[model samples]
Target: MESSSELADIKMVLAALMQGMNDTKGKAQVVEPKQEKPSAESEGVEGEEDVDIVQHETNAEEDKGDEGGLATYMKMHQDFYASLHYTRVQEMCKQKNIQYFRKDMGAWELARLDLQEYKDMLKGGKP
Candidate 1:
C-alpha cells in the first residue's frame, strides 16, 4: 500500500494542474476579438453613392466624346441602348441613322431623352 503523505502530494499536484488550466481559460476569456482592416473595394459608399459615381463618370466621358461630333454621340447612345437590351430602339436608331446629343447630360436627363426617342420610334417618326 502507498503512504498517506504520497497520496497527499498526488492530490496537491492534481489540484495545481486543474488550477493552472482554469487560469489559462480565464485569460482566454479576457482576450479581445481581432479587428479586420477595410479593403479598397469596400471603402466606398454602400449602394446609391456607388451608382451615382459610376453614372457621373460615364456621363463625363460621354460628354467629352460628344464634343467631337454628333456621329460619335449617336454611336455612344446606340451602344448604351444595346447594352440595356433595347433591341427595337437599337434597330430603329441604326435604320434611321438618327443624330443624338450627349453633351452635359446627367443620368436622369439621358434616361428621359432615351425614353422620348423610344416613344417617337414607336409612333413611326424620327427622334
Candidate 2:
C-alpha cells in the first residue's frame, strides 16, 4: 500500500515536469544581431566585382647580385658551418674577419658569429 502511494507521487512529479517542458516549447525568443552598413570604398565602384587590393614592396638590396647571394648562401649552408670543428670554424671566422672571441666561444658560437657578421655586412654594417 505504501509502495503504491510512493509510485503515484513519482508519476505526479514526472507529469508536472513534462507539462512544464511542453508549455515552454515553441515559446523561446531568438535574437538576431544587427548588420552594419558597408563603407563606399569597401563597396567599390559600380560594375567591378568586389575584390581586395594589396600592395607589395620589394627590398632594393635583395635584388643586387653578390650581396643578395651571400644572404641566400649563408642560409642554405648554416648546418654545414655549424658542423665544422672548433678550430676550423675559428679559422674561417679569422679569414672572413668575423669579430668573435675564440677564447670564450665553442664551434657553434663561432659559426653563428660568422653568419651574423655576414648578415650585418650585407646590411652595410661593420665588416
Candidate 3:
C-alpha cells in the first residue's frame, strides 16, 4: 500500500516536471531574409560557393540579442553556466549581491543571476 502511494506521488511530480518543461519550450520567431532580384552584373557569374544562410541568420540574431539585454545573454550561454560548480555559482552570486535561494537553487540558476549582476554593473546599475 505504501509502495502504491509512493508511485502516485512520483507520478504527480513527473506530471509537474513535464508541465514545466513544456512551459519553458518557447517558440523562436524566424526572420525572413529579404531576397534581391538578380542583376545583369551578376547574370554571367558562375562556380561561386553557396553560403550557409542559416548560420548567418543565427549570427545576426545573436548580435541583436547582445544589444537587447541580459535575458538573451543568459539564454545564449546556458551551457557555460551549467558547467560551473554550485559552490562557485553561489559564491559569485554572493559577491555580486544577487539574491538566490541558498539551498534550493542549482548551479545554473545561481550562475545566471551572477552573470546578470555582472552585466548590470557593467551598465552602471547597482544590481
Candidate 4:
C-alpha cells in the first residue's frame, strides 16, 4: 500500500515537471551581446594576430628573395603559436602521426612549444 501511494506521488511530480519543462524550452529569451570597441593596446596584440598572419604572408611575397626574412617570419609565427587552440594542437599531433592523450595534456603547454614543425605541420599535410 505504501509503495503504491509513493508511486502515485512520483507520477504527480513527474507530470508537473514535464509540463513545466515545455514552458522553459519554448519561452527562452535571447539577447544579442553589445560589441565593445577594443583598446589601442589590445588592438595591436590579440586583435591583430590573424590580420598579422595574412599581412605577413602578403608582405613575404614582396620579399620573396629574402630567405632570412622568410625564415624570420615563420619563426615569429611559431613564437606566438601558444595562442592556438588545443584541438588544433591535437589535430597537428594526428597529422604528424604523433600519439598523445589529449585529456592528459593542455592546449597552453602544447602551444607554448617552440617547435615550428609541429605548429605548421597541419598547414598542407595529411592527418
Is candidate 2 or 3 superior in lDDT?
Answer: 3
Candidate 2 TM-score to native: 0.25
Model 1: residues >4 Å from true position, as ranges?
1-27, 47-127
User: Candidate 4: what lDDT?
Assistant: 0.59
Across residues 1-127, which tens digit of lDDT does each residue of candidate 1 receive?
A: 4688899999999999887774654465566878888678787744534344354335777677655355454557645654553454544444555443432233224545665575567568645
lDDT of 3: 0.68
What's the lDDT for residue 97 in model 1?
A: 55
Per-model TM-score, in order, reads 0.18, 0.25, 0.31, 0.23
For model 3, name the residue pairs that clash: none
Residue-wise C-alpha lDDT for candidate 4, range 23-65, written one tens digit per residue? 6656679989999998887877873444443543356655776
Worst 10 residues of 1 by lDDT: 99-108
Score each candidate by Cα lDDT. Answer: 0.56, 0.67, 0.68, 0.59
Off by over 4 Å in 3: 1-44, 47-69, 76-78, 85-104, 125-127
* Clashes per candidate, residues 3 or more apart or on different chains: 0, 0, 0, 0
Pick the lDDT winner: 3
Shift in Å, residue 13, candidate 2: 52
Model 2, residue 20: displacement in angstroms? Answer: 48
Clashes of 4: 0
Q: What is the lDDT of residue 114 in candidate 2?
A: 62
Candidate 3 C-alpha lDDT tens digits along 3-122: 999999999999998877855346667779999998987776756766676673357776776775576667655656557776766776677666657523544565476577767778
Q: Give the runs in model 4 whose Cα sits over 4 Å from its true position.
A: 1-67, 99-127
